[model samples]
Target chain A: MPSDGITAVKQLFTRLVYSLGRETATRELKWMKQALIASHSPTLAAMLQRRLSGEPLQYILGTTPFGPLDLLTRPPTLIPRPETEDWTLRLADMLTPTPVRPLTVLDLCTGTGCIPLLLCHLWPPGSTRAYGVDISQHAIRLAADNAARCNIPSFQPAPYSQNVFIPVLGDLRDPDVFKRLLPPFDIITANPPYIPKREYDKLPVSVKNYEDPAALLGDPPDSEEQDGLTFYRLISKILRQKGMLRDGSIVALEVGRAQADAVEGILQQSAGLRNTQVWKDPWNVKRVVLARA
Target chain B: MSSPEDIARARQLKELEPLHEAWSNWTHARQSLEETLPLMQDPDPTMRTLASEEFTSLTHTLSTHISTTFPSLLVPPSSTRDLHALLELKAGVGGSEAALFLLDLLRVYVRYAGSVGWRTSIIQSSETESGGMRDAILEIKGEGAYDALRWESGVHRVQRVPATESSGRTHTSTVAVIVLPLSEDAESMSGNDELFKMEDVKVEVMRARGAGGQHVNKTESAVRLTHTPTGITVSMQDERSQHQNKRRAFQVLRARLMDVKLSQDIANRRATRRNLVRTADRSEKIRTYNYAQDRVTDHRIGLSLMNLTSFLEGDGVQDFLDALRRNWQEEVMEDVVGESE
Candidate 1:
């Protein structure tokens, strides 16, 4: 028999499972079934069709899992690259394995508040307060909305439905912005816009068109300096001056592939920075830079 | 005949298609509702209620889209002067030798403004004692004058040889410009009869100096008008007489106040866009003119102009302005459209 919407969805999901590994396939299908019941609309067929047409399943579903948390990812806020999520969980493990003291954390250029919210959820109660700052208001709203959606399941009672994620609006480039934010924390994390203009032009179509130009390119108009490193310089200065981080507080930055050397160079030249270390992503590309001040 | 579980499975399958339809058709349904709004202005109670609800929902979506897409194009007014609404412009910077570079920048803008039939008057200028201006504020009066010049704010560094330095060394210097509309609400067609309240302004008179000739030190011809509430200070020392200086200072102040008000209105219409985005982060180096490379690069848009000699020397500047204007207008329109969605 020719397939019905449910049969087509089933086949499409089977293909999705086959594309992913077996364990993941099983888990995702289980969720997909739940989503089908929850959505209770024929749009699930359209969602399947869109996914089959090469639209990201995340885009169709409108939410994805980040550690134990569910996040809404949309255009400009960057669909939380699984790799970034992996780095987040890794950072969480290193910082909060056995909470010794209350942890103050800052997530800079926090587009969708994904990292900070997860950090809050993973850390021990009252031991961590997370801050997410983004220059884009829509991104902040998306992040705030995601925070709400992720903390409580759709059906949860009203009183318990808060993600408790604090989202601030301001540019990272502004020195005064840090002063208005909550007091400094034990760790500062950011995955800033690092691609040089030329390199940004060559980004895959998925990124070049959908994301904001500021997020894609490091420097825009008159910057003589490599624009990607400007945020790092600003962050390093803010950390040193604000006392947000204790002396020897940790800084973990996710960097572009070839940016390790230049970033390191800036960190070394910068005052009050020390113990700079680089870590590789699962792909073995030098991805994260962990530093202490 | 199907078992109850099989029947439930088929029912689940049937439910999948509508969910898919609902999600995919959301934007389209929203758009159609927007398009049909103007046609349904019925006077009947039930029809009016139905229409009002639909119109409200459509307008909400449009405004939300606008807030999301063009978040920083407008700025709110926290003060009377609306200082945040002023247009930003930058002159190219070079070094000590860059005095000539700044002079060249001044000439380029004055000429470009002239080309558009705009009346340009230098309201206040501080010269480098050696030569050229340390900083200068020029008031251009024309149709769309402030709107045209607002994008130029940022540090301009010029690189070239100075006429005073015999060693033929190139120096870099900087000049910043602020353009404001004559009245916050008035465009080019608006009459210039409207005057700002003098009570809010502090006017001071002093001697005029710089390139204006020998009468520079003798007379109290220079005028400084400070809008106390907004802290927007304007001075006109370039004119020859006190009356002329006062008029120029007031004109500049009016333009600035108007620009601020206009921006405030735009921001009010798109508050989320302005509040979330740093529209007037003028201190951020927006563009740089490199004498070595003969290039002018904008860091915000990543656009670089190779014809530096022509651009800085008061020669072929319209192309750059046109490009910037196109980008800014596009951004503004995007915000408007987004708000309407």
Candidate 2:
């Protein structure tokens, strides 16, 4: 029996697992062993080596379940985080008690269309139409594929109806493109790039190297003191435009660590927007900002 | 006398009662305006301002009644108003140019459906060799899909330089659009099994054509059905299974039958009415898309607007639909008023 080879591989994986912290190491180790057993390929051993070198677990698995959806996870597009999943479910719960009307939702920086897809799944079909916009073409394509794959019920009656999820390729950085968007949306949600420039370097090698730079960083930090708030500013400005934000509509945004206050300030400064509030994540950090128009 | 015609006439008058009430409200507001005009010259400045404001408010109310409430009263209740629509687009003439325009027209509707939250799916399509669509059938499913898209049926002419053309000279191409309301009883009709006599139908199975590769060609998955009485043949090869193809072929056949029945009813109604509404004529060129001028001209209502690109992308088509509905209501009102007289 080649006991040395199995023990050596387990030891290497244990070191890699330890890097993720003791709390997650056991689970990650078990998952890696299960994956290895399932594939039983030498190539998977190479993948394990890559994972040991700090490749994101999502990329290694190729998929992650967000709410009721199994979303395809690929490199370059930001992986669906647990923080996002928590807030999205909370948002859905908030809207579930409301009267059913033809509601329109717009999601900015819709990485994997996770927000819109999950919302559409949670909301009653035919009453909600959700649009997801991302700057990256790859994200847009992947999001569209996910939308098609999910097969969410659309308001369209039988014979010709399709999924209500629409993925648009657009850069929120451009005010002109933002202005061109059709308005009167009932809800707007965003999980934009909010990681500060200084924080990017401090991020684990897995996130810094494997994840998309566009997904993690906002407009180049103007100064050392400036935090990532480029998307929040642009979104707020666009929302302030005449006929952009509908009366009594809600805008929910996922914020970075300790950035909720700044995001709330941005929303409060925007015309017609009020009742800014910050929501804490499961870990008790203020991770989301909610505002009403 | 209480004859059937008299009963119908009385019922119609009762239906018009709401319009009469709106007219009376307008008249009352106008009377108030007349009364306020004299009060505007009152000795007190506050009274004058009050009278002027009253006059402005009354005038606004009167206009709103005429534009919205009055027109809404004129629209005859339609049974097929809530039904989904089957919109078919086919290249009429100008060869590949027409095909290209047909494709663009299809995109316009699809994008428009997306914006409005309506769902659209291509039922069948025959593609031209040049990557243009020769014919396409779309099923637009949503609440009031038929009502919104009913006026879209007609010949749509486009004036643009063809991609195949060497010169920049503008060429005209025509695409015919036919809109039919999907039967509300589609499920029951399909399930009845006895709706169409078996002896009068011919069914054939063949290899599926187009993009499916070796597996598609190897198996006889395509199904074609021909109605012996009407000589209408429908072939569906999109599905991998012959059963699915057969089912789809039957669906198309049923829709066609329903369309024929509805058109006959429309024709009979048209024959009875002396004043013909030219807008309903499918042969008429209802709209013109001029790329050179960046304009879309709807010939029926004389609506010509710039921003052809946006219009083609399904952004401004709602305005056109609204205008068409308004025109239709006005025409129906005229017919009702004439009949009452």
Candidate 3:
């Protein structure tokens, strides 16, 4: 009923609707209102105005729901998507129902510890252990905060420990990353940066501007051979060389729309992974590749 | 002929009989603790040490019995306690802001479900032009889903300035959350050919709206089902094929019908204890989210928490839930105690 406020609200809402669609815009506006109220800072309102001008809401809110965990979002880590949530929950359900032995899960390139936190939460506590490794210190720190906030037990190295969730900082590209890990893991999940540089550039301004490029484009594709497949190759090689994957263990990775075949190939050729399967997300797009080792 | 109240009291006493035996065990443990207490101060050093150890162990056992085993006996388990939940969120007052708040409420439940390992899915949703959900139905399936989410019914009001506001004045918006327990038998009933007669359902197909590229306008993929007798309608458009949409729509319809049947049963059971506590009412404003002060107050329980952001983010909502469950149990215990008197 306040005409000026209504007009302003409509304008801000319109911009958000344009960029994020109506649902997301509405959510972002609510978050902005909350952020404004929490900080009592006019700058927070200004940030919402910026969001209306095409800023990602996750960056503005500084947190996003990742599966069951509320993960802190900074510029350094990639935002967890709905696809990741679907696969992680699916994998958790797959593993938890008939776990014959004490299971161990290793999440590679764990952005905000979503996968591991969810895995630990779903799996029977004292029987299943999970470790999340990410190269970014900021991501690791955020993941640790999520683990503590979600009340998942932290990793304790004692034999057959009850603690289930652990976040470690290390590069997946490095062979030495496997050294500190307690492996022969029953399951490994990764949602590494799989977008090629060209595809990344074409992303919506909200993503291109706010999200880290390193979290989107792993390394510049050096030829037709190297496009977004570097992380998969590195992970498979490390697992194979270190003998880190237990027999009959699964390595599940979230892949881009058309990247599932390439990812499956990489895992099969390098890791000697067998029985590869591609899973479609809710959107019916090929999103995850699951391979047994 | 006995009144319903008399029957309920009889039932309560019958349930309490086993618990009363467990209660006697607690009395015995307390007696053991009292007997051991005097020996802790014995004159002989060896005797004193032995007595102290026995006293400590007996006290620990008594404390555990009192804390864990004793309080659990008070609340009688209801048939609906372990059922799955279907949570529907509808935008109430304050227009689009209410729709936005509905989305927030949905996220809170979804995230909370995820944290507890419950599986949740949006069975039906109608989004406003501005991206806010007009109404959404979420099915949360897992052990104790209904038990955890039943208190989440009723209206949730949010107080804060609208993001679209130029002159920054706080506004209040309400979103109604209706949580219905999904019967485990509903899954079997869905498969039963006679549960919902095909002749009773009016099926309609339409072109799906919003973001399927060329497929959105070209194909009549969305399916709507209206049960002619009950006037219950469900629409599903998210899936690609019309067949899939029809299946989903029918599934939701069956669940809704099941909910109605279950609610009637609940109403009957609840009629006996109507004076003990207010039944779940959707029109009631159960909770308030005051963002300006970073506070959330559950009006039903009279519990106020200062961490509104965390609560909305699905972190601190558990506090309110825990308190509500505890309070509900306490009320049940009081009702039982009153009936005994």
Candidate 4:
């Protein structure tokens, strides 16, 4: 029987081997040998202890790569993952400026504001107005900071648009959050917390200890009815209400393991979305589920 | 009368194939011209005309080979012969003028590489405020890149009236160009144990702390490899990824470590070093580019070439390279003959 109880990850190799490439593995280990010779700061033993104890390197370094941008990350907000980046790129590929209209995007639970910021960076500076909505102020602040840090250069022929990425702090549970959003979006991308309460305890210490629990857990905190699909159900309800999504626009969301079918069904039945599709990540697991309104 | 040791030593001695081919071609053409001399005296008018044409052509061929072809056994057999080259140029005397000349020297190399169909990339370049390069490393990757540019190691002095000067007084500025051989597979360089020890070097990276997977956001890694023993530090941040920076740093480190090792080896073998034409000293001025006389002169061989404009533009420089190479080979042959005596 698998010990960690995670459905997706193959436990064939140790987590450490799965985590870093051989070059980086050796590079990190090199500091140990280096410490013996030079007595440098962040010595081998200290780095090993920090890593072995399940602290994130990015959190320690305070910066992470999001597409072309370098984003500042903290423990309060979820760090951007490679899987998220993969699906985001796939999502970005689906969107293009109509001959007449500019592309507008709204990214929910935008930890590090990586999604909207990446879309902004990929798009012409004035071609996009991406809004990143997260309940946590820390997430919104970090996302806003990343927007300034990236400062993507715009090429000519792209008409100027105001504020490419706007970090909005709004709770998903509240009905009033939709009032803050700019309507008629071309794309609505979300990487919401989808892990059920029962599955949360089984997560690796690296994730459970370092990252925010609210960002990973699908259930609302301290609520009696703790369904894993709280955010997804709310997003569908929000979609059903007119003014958020325009014609031909989509709501593409990153999902947890084995939840793509469940999320797709919810979007189709409740949100009045048709042609819902499930996209697989590199690991061959369906990681993102999308539906067109 | 030749033993196995003698044969092996001869094989290891020099890269003389091109020189040997030139000599053989020159001698064969001379022999053919001698044969045609008698044919020119024949009674048949057509035969005489054909023979005279053949003699003239053969004489021209022999003269071209003598004047332009690399002299016999000039280039020493080197591990560098099969490798690529990293041309490092640093501005030496006369401040900004030296820096500008360095830029000109870099352009000349890039242009030369372009003409020869060799690929050149400016690996590390820092430009001066006066529209010049302070120091730069141009990577030339092609067959015979190192061999063609190996003799271009020492100081190249440029005599020109400064564009920045108020009065037109010729100022002597220098640009030091060092050509170092680089292996195609960078692993061979970093893997070598004799030149540098893995233990002596300390690789300083942003200590990648994390649970070791997708859970941590990967950084834009910057690597700095320090030789703890020599205090030689190579910091690389130009590459997008950390792994590439480390690999690039290791390659440069390998080249520099080899430089240090070879310098020590040459110093230890002072007796044997006297016979070689190329000195290890990079500080000494080897070539002088005189704008006043429109001449480019190689100080070592006492050879002067006219049309300095075309030379700086990378056309006429080949003539000097060929001449110096031939002269170097002649000197080695003399030393070898003297040893046999």
Number of the top lDDT candidate: 2
> For residues A166-229, what per-residue lDDT tens digits would candidate 1 score against the true structure?
7788987687777765566678898777777766666554455555666656665688876567
Q: What would the TM-score be for candidate 1 when compared with the true structure?
A: 0.40
- What fraction of the reference structure's interface contacts does model 3 contain? 0.00
Q: Could you tell which candidate, 2 or 3, scores higher by TM-score?
A: 3
Give me the candidate number with maximum TM-score. 3
Candidate 4, residues B229-314, lDDT tens digits: the string is 78888876554345456677887777777667766665665476465544647887899999999998888878888889888875
The DockQ leader among the candidates is 4
Q: Rank the candidates by lDDT, best first.
A: 2, 3, 4, 1
Q: After superposition, how far is residue B27 of candidate 2 from its true place, in Å?
A: 10
Q: Write the per-residue lDDT of candidate 2 for residues B1-341, one digit (tens) a residue.
A: 69999998996897678878888998899899889999999999999999999989989998898778876776677756668778989899789999999999999999988888988888777766577888888988886888889999999999999998998889999999988777555523133353466677777655322212100112234568888888989887654334445666777777676777777777788788764554377888999999999999999899998999888864889889999988887787777777778
Candidate 2 docking category? incorrect
TM-score of each: 0.40, 0.47, 0.54, 0.50
Cα shift from native, residue A261, model 2 (Å) = 83
Q: Write the per-residue lDDT of candidate 3 for residues A96-191, one digit (tens) a residue.
A: 533346787888888788888877776765777788988788888888888888777665763453547788888776777766776678888888
- Chain B alone, TM-score, model 2: 0.79
> iRMS for model 3?
10.6
Residue A122 lDDT in candidate 1: 75
All DockQ scores: 0.00, 0.01, 0.02, 0.07
Name the TM-score of chain A in model 3: 0.87
Rank the models by DockQ, top first: 4, 3, 2, 1
DockQ score, prediction 2: 0.01
Fnat values, one per model, are 0.00, 0.00, 0.00, 0.11
Candidate 2 chain A weakest ten by summed lDDT: A154-163
What's the distance in Å from true for residue B85, model 1? 68
